[model samples]
Target chain A: MAKKRILIAKPGLDGHDRGAKYVARALKDAGYEVIYTGIRQTPEAIVSTAIQEDVDFIGLSLLSGAHNELFPRVVELLDNKGAEDIIVFGGGVIPIDDFDYLKSKGVKAIFTPGAQIKDIIDFIELQN
Target chain B: MSLNEIIAKKFSSWEKNVLEKLLKKFPERQKEFLTASSEKVERLYLPFENEQEKYIRDLGFPGEFPFTRGIQPTMFRGRLWTMRQYAGFGTAEESNQRYKFLLSQGQTGLSIAFDLPTQIGYDSDHPMSEGEVGKVGVAIDSLKDMEILFDGIPLDKVSTSMTINAPASVLLAMYIAVGEKQGVPREKLQGTIQNDILKEYVARGTYIFPPEPSMRLITNIFEYCSGELKNFNTISISGYHIREAGSTAVQEVAFTLSNGIEYVKAAVNAGLDVDSFAGRLSFFFNAHNDLFEEVAKFRAARRIWAKIMRDKFSAKNEKSLLLRFHTQTGGSTLTAQQPDNNIVRVAIQTLAAVLGGTQSLHTNSRDEALALPTEDSVRIALRTQQIVGYESGVTNTVDPLGGSYFVESLTDSIESEAQTYISKIESLGGMISAIEKGFIQKEIQDSAYKYQKDIESNERIVVGVNKFSVEEKPPKGLLRVDPKLRDLQIKKTTEVKKNRNNEKVKKNLSALKVASSDPNANLMPFIVDAVKEYATLGEICSVLRETFGEYKENIVL
Candidate 1:
């Protein structure tokens, strides 16, 4: 089977990339080809990276409380580009109160802090 | 037989006769025990039969040279560590309310948290700052916002620590201006500006200018503060972000001290006296889950710094050798699953910090891992420190864990290990070259990955994460910043620009640019002048960004 490709990206101005980097490395270790966009990326930049890489999933991580704005923007951009099939998931210091809203806006899974790598991998594997 | 030989023999005999037999029937829970940093835990620690000479040389009395036990003679007995909660969110008006509330609830000091745009030298209205205004911290675009941020609060009465870097000079200038407005002179202002940028290049990602200009700005602050803001802490060489970015306790101490060395060297090279500025240098560290290791890390840091100042720099002032520091409970240790459990985690970390003889501390709120902490959570965090300071009897004595065999041995081990890392950094042409070459970043990432792998493999247990699993509802009442905040801040910045004297603002900014272009010129006065003219942070930063250029990070992972 061809390896599932995933792009791990940090959007907005936050530099707290420990969680993003950890998940990126873990996904790579779990036999997925991962492309990580470093901190302070724009939603347009992320959408372009995902399309250019032709990845199956985009993992958006933000910790600066801009997830409500940035995460939905990424999903909307992907949809506007007719790339809605490219699954978008999110993580970081996101409050649970925003989960249903984010999921409703096209984020497949919302991983808050304390989410295990196995859980993330399982979510990805289940998508298959 | 000598005492060392006899103890060694007795230890081996006891291990063989008593431990092996007991282990055969009731085996230990795990094959090996390890600390949060993944260092091995010894089965037992015994006193080494050292002569009285070693004690006198290594572990001296408190408030003396080579202050290993504690920095002050009375320690907490004379004064308890200041409970400074790191708080700020939303607009200046909103955050000011929070600060006032904290003061009313008995917070002794204020630690200002600035939003990402402000930390990165952007005003609230910048295109890049969209959706990010006042999310993580308070947003201040000019002197107007700063004035409102500290309105009605007497500057001389409370010590304030502003976690600002890259643009630290501008923020400090605004602070001084605010003091002047309150009839308090610059010299009477007491506070700290987290002017450390080396750590930003390696751990936090708030850096703006490249290293050459960044170091110059730091040295400029050192020189400026020595002559003017004598009571202000010019720089807080920090390891808290380094640890939060996932370095071990030893690496935290080593890398932070190495950065300190780089800063001192830069100041001396800039023709400043070492004693003139070294006395004002402070440190910030993180307190993690491991009680003994964290305690040992703090103690080892003090001893190592004292030795470095005395032996390496030949610092003459007694104040130069003291390693006064503030500690914050580990933010990464908080679990998002069982939010209530974090209160317990914070309490343990609070005890570890107090036991380590910290000069001040910030306790992480229970909901920090999820969102900005609510008022209830912040109060609990503050109360955690108060209970440890007043209720816990650990404050009765100085360096209460000084002579314990386990703590002493651990302290020595940590000090030696940290020294090894520092020597390697020194050999690599100090911390800047090390960071530029990606050595420090790689080491931290490797440790971070290993830590995550251990947790996933069930080798390390984070309560409510890898072990002691539970099913629970999602957390409620997580603090949310209003989306309209960005608009309001943008309007304020626009109004300030429209109302202020545009000609004077232009002159000040151009003067700043000219000063920035000169290698020998100190940029503090120029920055202060620009700030007082209602020059927006983005405008001022753009002027320097054109001159100094922005820093491009070396992404290690």
Candidate 2:
């Protein structure tokens, strides 16, 4: 199979990117093409990067407690552009109550900290 | 036989008879064990085998020269480490309530966490600040918001530490103006600004202007504080964010001290005497999980800083040689899987920080890995420190772990490794050049990568992560900031801008713009004047952006 293109983008002002980079590297090592837009990316920048990179999945990471506003905004932006199939997934310092709310808003999956990299890979494979 | 020879002989026989026998039956857990700093741990530490001569030279009594044991002679017995919790979120009014609550609960100091917009020098109303205002911390746009934030708090009585960078000058200027309003003279102001911007380039990503102008702004604060706010710590040379950004304990020490070196150099080059400002110089560090390693890191930091001040810069004042630091238990260590386990993790880290002799401390809450800590969680975090202070019995003596054979060795090891890193930065033409070359970022990325790999591979076991995790119901009751805060803050900023005398604000900002280009001119007075005129932080910093320009990071990965 051709390598699945994935864009690991940080959407918001949170500079803590260890998780995002870690997932990107893991995806790359698992034979996926990964494009990581660096920190402080806005929703528009993230959506535009997804469209430009033509990625199969968008892995959004945020830790600054701006996940509720920024993460859904990315999904909503993708939906407005008819790029809903881009498969938005995310992980951050998100509360449990927000998980169903996020999933209902088109976030395909949500991973919290201490989540295994392999589980993320499995989640992506299931989506495909 | 000599005492050293006899001890060596006994250790050899014990290894063969006891250690080897146990290993043969049950097998060793791993081929080798390493600390968080990648230092190999010996199975046993013997007196003659360790560095005795170096210990006598380096690990002198508490409050003595070099200050390896502790800075104060009495340590905690004189007064306990100030239990300061880093708190802020939503509107200024809400955050002020939280501060008052903490103070009532026995918090000795106040540490404010600013929102992303405020931290990056943007007013809450700015288009770029949409969806981010008051999400992570309190949003302040003008003196109005700052005035409300400290509404009832006496400025001179409480020590405040604001974790703001890039826009540190604006915040400090506003603070001085607030102090003036409160009938507290500038000299009576006690606070610290996280003005260390080089780390923003190396670790954190909230940098506004480039390194050159950032250093200029920092030196301006140093000079201003030296002349006026004598009790205020102009800049907190911080490693808390560095460690949170995924650096080893050694890198945390080395890079933090290296950044400190750059600031001192810049201030001295700005024609300020080192001793005049260095006495009020404070440090912020992260206390991680490893008990001895964390303790050793603190000791090493103090010793190295003392040597640098006394020898390298020839600082005459004894206070200049004293490295007073505040520590926060590592936030990155909090595990979301077993949120309750984080309490124990914080306790261990808090003990390490106390034993390490931190002047002030903040213990991370259990639910922080999920969201901003709620009132209950914050109280528990504060109680963890109190239990250690009142009940733990470890505080009765200073540097209780001082003469441990293992601790002394680890202290020396970390100090030497950190010195090597400083030397490398010096060779690369100091921290700015090294950061521009992406050397420092690459080092941190590499360290973070290795650490994550170790956790992933179970080489380093984080309990409830790789080891003892049980299926947990998702954590509930995590604190959530009100979404309407964005609009409220924007409205507040709009009102301030509309009501302030436009011509005066305009003239003061333009003067600030003119002064931004001059190397010799101190910009603090101009910033303070503009802040007094109710000029928004964005307006003042926008002038600087036009003059010095924003910094773009050269991300290595």
Candidate 3:
């Protein structure tokens, strides 16, 4: 199979990008073309980039507790652009109470801190 | 036989017989044990591991020239490291209560954490600040909020450290105005503003203006504070966020010192004497899990900084040569899996900081990984530092780990490795150019990748994470910020706008605008005036954004 293209974007004012960059590098090492949008990206920018790059997956990362508002906006923007098929996963210092709500709003999975990259890869591979 | 010859012979015999038998029975875990930075670690470090003759020079007496041992002669024996608990969230009044609570509980210093909106120079009522008002830290919209934040706290009596950057000038102006209102003069104000913006671009990501203008603002603060606030630390060139962002300990020291060099160069180029501003320069570093490495990192940092100040900057003042630092235990190390485990992690990291001869320290709370720590969690974190200071006999001696073969060898190794990085940064035209070219960011990213990769492969053991796995119920008592805070803060902002002198605010802001355009004009006085007029942080920063333009971060991986 052709290598999956993943767009790892930080769609908020939160500057903590260690998790996002780590995941981006891990995916690239695992044979995926990863496009990383650096910190303080807006929801519009993330959705537009996802559409422009035609990425297979979108990984949204936030740590500033703005994930609840910011993460879903990216998904909602994707849906508005008729790009709901693109798999969207979320990660960062997200609380457990937010997991189901995010998943229901189209976040395919939630990767909390200390989550293994292998499990993330498995989840992505299983999607195929 | 000579002592070296006899020891060599004994070691060779043991390795050939005992090591071979042990390895054959159960092969070594790896080809070689390495530190997180990938530095080789010998199975046993000996006295001969380091050059014995260089000991006097390398490990100088504390409080003397080239201070490698400690900054003070009687370190911690005379005074304990300040227990500064980094806390703030919600409205200014709410955060003020937390500060009082911490002070009442024996916190020696107050470290304020401004909310996201306040940090980014947004008013609480701004559309961009929606849902973020007073979430991550305390919201300060204007001098009114600043007044409430320090209402009862005596500015001259207590040391305050505000973790504000990017819009640091506005925050500092508010603080100065608050101090003035408290009948305290500028010279009496004692605290740090974390006015360092280079690290914001390199690690923390709270930068507002572009690098050139950012450096200009920093130099302005240096010039102003050197003359007015003699007791205040102008900038805290930080590696705490860098280490938290996944750089190795060596990189932390290198990058942080490189930043210090850049700031000194900028100040001198702006025609300020290096000794005047450099004396107030402080450092902040993260205390991670590695005990020996962290201790060595601090010692190496002091030695390297002393050399930079003495040889490079040609600093004359003894205070300018000293590399004083505040340490906060690693927040990234806190795990949500076994929340209680963080207390142990914090205790270990705090011990390392205390043993490393830190001037001040903040211990991470056990519940920090889940959310803002509750009062109980915050108290425990403060108590962690207290126990190390009072109960742990480590504070009685200065640089107690100074002569350990392993520590000395590691300190030398870290210093040399960090020097290489510093030279590389200098070759790239200093830290600003290096950051703009994405060199520092890329190095940190690579380090972060390798670290996570090791953790995932089980090469590194993070208790309760990859190893010691546990299935427990969700942790509780984590601080939950009330959503109504946003509404309350917005209401307050609106009220302040309605009550403040509108015309006076306009005049002060325009005056600031005029001052900001002139390259030579010190913007601090203008900002202080504007803040006194109760001009909101967002308004002042908007004027600056219009004049100097906002920074659009460069995306690099």
Q: Pick the candidate with the highest DockQ.
A: 1
Model 3, position B267, has a per-residue lDDT of: 91
Per-prediction DockQ comes to 0.79, 0.69, 0.66
User: Per-residue lDDT tens digits of candidate 2, residues B284-348?
Assistant: 99999999999999999999999999988999999999889999999889998888889999999
Of 1 and 3, the candidate ahead on TM-score is: 1
lDDT, candidate 3, B1-557, per-residue tens: 87878888999999999998998999977898987677789999877633566677898799987788999999988999999999999888999999999999999999999988888878988777766777789989988989999999999999999999889888888889999999999899999989989999979988888888888999999998988999999889899999999999999999999999999999999999998899899999999988999999999999999999999989999999999999999999999899989999999999889888899999999988888889988889998888888888998888999889899989999999999999999999999899989999999988988888888888888999999997888775567778788888878878988999999999999999998899999999999999998899999989988888888777777
Winning candidate number (TM-score): 1
Tell me the spans in candidate 1 whose CA falls farther than 4 Å from its real position: none
Query: Which residue window of length 10 is worst by lDDT in model 3 chain B?
Result: B47-56
Clashing pairs for model 2 are none
TM-score of chain B of 3: 0.98
Error of 1 at A54 (Å): 2.1
Q: Give every collision pair in model 1.
A: none
Residue-wise lDDT of candidate 1 within B1-557, one digit each (tens)? Answer: 98889999998999999999999999989988888898888888888677467679888899997898889999999999989999999988998999999999999999999999999999887777988999999999999999999998999999999999999999999999899889998899999999999999988999999999999999999999999999999999999999999999999999999999999999999999999999999999999999999999999999999999999999999999999999999999998888889999999999889889999999999988888999999999999998988898999999989888888888999999999999999999999999999999999999999998888888888888888979898777888899999999989989999999999999999999999999999999998999888998888889999999999868888
Q: TM-score of the candidate numbered 3?
A: 0.97
